[model samples]
Target: MGQPLAPPPVAGDLSDRLVATDVWTDGMLAEHGIPVVDVPLVTFGGGIGSFVTADYLRICGVPTSAIRVLTPLETPWQSYEYLTTVSQIPRTERLRSDSASTPDNIWGFPSYALREGLQGDLKQLWNVLVEPIWANYYTPRAGAAFTAMEKEMHRIRYPEMVVRGQVRMVRRRAGGGYFTILTPPQGAAPTRRIAYRSQWVHVAVGYPGLKFLDDLQEYRKQTNDYGSVVNAYEPHEHVYEKLRAKPGVVLVRGGGIVASRVLQRLIDDRDRFRLDTQIVHLFRTYTATPHGTGILKRRKGADGWAYQGFNYPKSVWGGQLKQQVRKTEGAERARLYKEMGGTNTPVRRDWQEQLSRGRAQGWYRVMIGQIDRMTKTGELVEVAVASDQGPQLGSFDAVVDCTGLEADIREHRVLADLLDHSGAGRNPVGRLDVERTFEVRGTRNGNGRIYASGSATLGGYFPGVDTFLGLQIAAQEIADDLHAQGFGSKLGPGRSTSQWWKWFRNQQI
Candidate 1:
């Protein structure tokens, strides 16, 4: 019942569009010198992953003001929320979760929704809804929750000391600790000559950004126009906007969650705005028919998941296969990631039902195939699809590639440099190898630990560490590690109680 998530504004002047402009200005940079100041801890990626890490460190007694959340900040989930909600992740959509999941709200405190419910007649529902109790990962408006996490970052003051910049590179200090170099925004130069040296560094720059398929990447490079074709994870507003302007079929390429959400958005627009947006979903695998029986229905689809499971499959969560994954490494890990959760699929049921009805009604159709060639003519795209239907031919108004995402560490210069020059190593899954605690695993070049979270750890040992809850879990682990090493303990249990009494004395709710 909260505000519907705002559709992402088209990218304009980025300076004007992004929030917290003051966090990274030339003046502040000019004010601080290159004098190597030593801080107890540092975390990578100024997103929820780092936010939670900082939060836990604060609770553990490290002054909230002591930690530096190093990264650019438009907001946590800034890109992802845009990708999901604008595409098809709706506000009311129910989440497909691991049964017990919370985003960065890892302390199991309440959100606006849970808090509101706590004051209602359905208080049982409220407590039941509270995560880590009865509620597993069935998230509601998961996208909204992600945006809400930004408020947590601000509320807890994690961003109080945010350095508005991307970490360009890092090098292990000769004696101990590490130094991280950064690239501030285009105009923020006076501070450009600054570096942060710390005893600990936690890397969470989630999967080296985005890696589209070779064919899709080639197509995008060739077209350089996102008018008729678009990648699901990026700003491809023109595709749907074009469909809105001219009513024709939108061929969504992928069998994953993004594809599902994109299709739903098209359907909703078609129904609500009266846009004649027909949709043709091109899934490489034909799942129009159920293939398995029992509780296993969610596993047999592909990737060891029951054909009915959401986002890879339920088994990816603590099931037998997940345990097997823990035992396996190298090619096995890569194969596991490929099989489970590698594909994108929306995690809502009503959308699935809607698409099913569309299939029944003919307004929506499904073709299991891959695109062989795409030629855009005037207002339409001639698509040659390779399918069991004997090489089907179709013309669509636009194609949205929801082919999921992959971020090769090599693409991220900081990680690559660390791997090559700084003595870091890739784990069994071919990512920045880190211990279970989220510390990047390589011979100790210094006391500072380089860790990663988000999509980068997709192939790591933890089950759902790549998701929101996973981010918090990684943060908790990192905070615990830092605490064990004696740092970031501002809000330990004692301090938390003190704050509670302070709130009570203020008569604050």
Candidate 2:
């Protein structure tokens, strides 16, 4: 067996002390001299999900002062941009996300295609119009999405509400509301932790953290050499740079989008620099045909990737699939989720052509198996694979694992605290359980409601709960729930139109 996994770092001593308390009273906090700031809403994990919700509330006439976004990120898209860039999707590259899933605009009116068309990219518009039948699905550029979100961020005055810190845990206040503890960066504040008391708490902590495979972790721990075995999410630019300097063989593990992008990057470098680089792709499950539960839902599959336009079937956003999932619960819902879930990537022609060329030239090879063991042997690494053809061994300059699986929610300090002390339970699929309105079902404290979006709350009611469109939908639901409770103005046609006009004019609210 591989080396046992190491424990994650604790949030802080404050988290240990706070986890035992179910409710915190004003007197209790006052005794410790902890400053408590009051706000109508407090959103943690200030990524795209938090930004979308804040944008919705702002559009509904909520003031910046009424909301507090507690996060450590310098910018809303900083985490997302980092992941994409390290995974080979530079600012110039297009994301696999759908064009119409605009996080900046809730209505998704004048989709990315229309915007690109007006900007003189008629090819994009045409491609979107024809879609799967004629042309491959179109996606917005990584930079374009970030640029749009930045514009929305300014229009909503998101910067004014940002509290730069890492959230420890949220505790229910004795009287009402919730106390969200934030640990500000060193030198940013005098206090060790600041507490924000809010009637509504929104948690959008995107993916708890990345999980490197056990074997890879074991190898790194034993040899203390991180250069040979690396994860795609982390910075491994040195791998490519070294390849550019000299001929090398790269063993790429996993068959997801990151794998395809890494392969493309390697091929591009090979063609551009006239370098002799060989690529070996390892797939756990190699698919050879279309797959799905129903005839109408078949997804294209070849080699290993289960190809789809988006992460989930587009129908999950609004059609029958959405309704089906919303109505089901427990085992049925989990079954449906399993049917829709798989590692998939959009079928891009350029990448496919490059792979075809690599195959024809014999520089690229596909292997069906997983790395059983990896050992550093001199300058190269020896990788043992347990394949259908029996045990196989290979030596490569570097082994890049592209399996993009996030660690368990419990790995996140705040999430773990929520599960242990805040009455937040796990859903059928083991993530945070949430209501239809994206509210943590049992996490209501008095009149206050705890809402959540993003990856942490997946498997509740939506299949695409982690996507851009999914986050927007969750934001709308949470906003609507808040509006019902008289927190913000109703975003009816008039308000939506006026705010949309402001967005169009690039005017800050």
Candidate 3:
């Protein structure tokens, strides 16, 4: 999140010959003194997406020695937790995800709600049963998801497959398979660079980095005041700490889930401390009414918020929208993404009540406008707005930017290198293009494949490629593809039942 995680050093790590070649040869890597390790399947990114894929393969009888996870993270959920915590959805707070979107359980049986009920939280189970009717959709807390993942991670012996390093690039092999170059934590290996030779390469690097609005970027660049203007995705607990010490006006931008969480945190503190902290919410495009492409696809909107229980429509998972996107191409695919994609937040009763109270008390204010610019005003931040009403301006003690995931795939060095040196292409929505089976299209080399998942493959045939359940779906597809390629056993009904039992019993695979 800070400084874009400095790209892997290149000066002494790569050789001229290796750098110049598009397809890498084993001999070439050896000649350059780059240690080559052979693994049948290699997946980088080491996040939840990568973990899901590896977990599926392991359950299908793939041995740990045959798979490798190259990443800089200490754990699969490290980045996810950091982002959620900073965005104000700490361990105790519920996530904006469905109860069944369990990354740990591939079958999604005994869902989060079921588990919660087993643990004495029958209210959550009831919430899911009557979701969007008598109650809001049930969501798992951040801690529950993480704890479950930790158990699965060990059950699958995921740690054994992990190779802690920063992936630099993936190139097609001269004969077959691919060569994945990794920058080992300085001195972790004899060579600066380690080349992983694998028949299949899976990429799930998630988002390249956090996105800051142009006005916020310029404000910080000009004033060098990061403390006052912070991205909700970054560590900014100090902002709340300072506000607790004194009553102040805080400006919040964006209309997504994070904005909701941040607002709740601010109001929660104000109530707990009996402080008079005022909140100014700015919505670029206020949704005052229901909006959608058609009557059947309409989303609920009101009070300057577009309400969605989850990130995408439920149909996108396997319903009409999924079928539509899979069959569509080019402009049609792009249009579908545009029609469905937008910033929205789930409707929570507690937060809604808090917001309503604040509104009535005249402590919460909503404005509709795009920021013209921002400037320093002593310890406060002055934001100029341009909206339908007219130009306006205000000053606040702090500005919390909640907009996120706007960075392009090319912003990531490895992804850029994949496009430039490898044969990877972009989808209609400008992310890494992939086949229905999640293989990176056009990058296939004899008998080998380069598969990708997660946000990087967002615009592919799958519309929900960025969610927890989405990752599991991609893993299923990719695992099936590998099975067809004679890598792992097929997950037939018998095998699936056995694996689910093993999972339920917490038995090691």
Task: Write down the lDDT of every candidate, Cα atoms only.
Answer: 0.62, 0.89, 0.90
- Give the range where candidate 3 is weakest over 10 consecutive residues by summed lDDT: 1-10
Model 3 clash count equals: 0
Give the alpha carbon lDDT tens digit for every residue of 12-104 in model 1: 112221121212222222233433445666776776677667766655657755677778767766655565655565456544443245454
TM-score of each: 0.79, 0.96, 0.97
**Candidate 3 per-residue C-alpha lDDT over 383-462 given as tens digits, one digit per residue, 9 for 90 to 100:** 89996689998999999988775698999999999999989999999999999999999999999999999999989899
Error of 1 at 386 (Å): 1.3
Error at 260, model 2, angstroms: 0.9
Clashing pairs in 2: none
Ranking by lDDT: 3, 2, 1
What's the lDDT for candidate 1?
A: 0.62
TM-score of 1: 0.79
Write out the backbone clash pairs for model 3: none
Report RMSD for candidate 2.
Answer: 5.2
RMSD to native for every prediction? 9.9, 5.2, 4.3
Model 2 compared with the native: what TM-score? 0.96
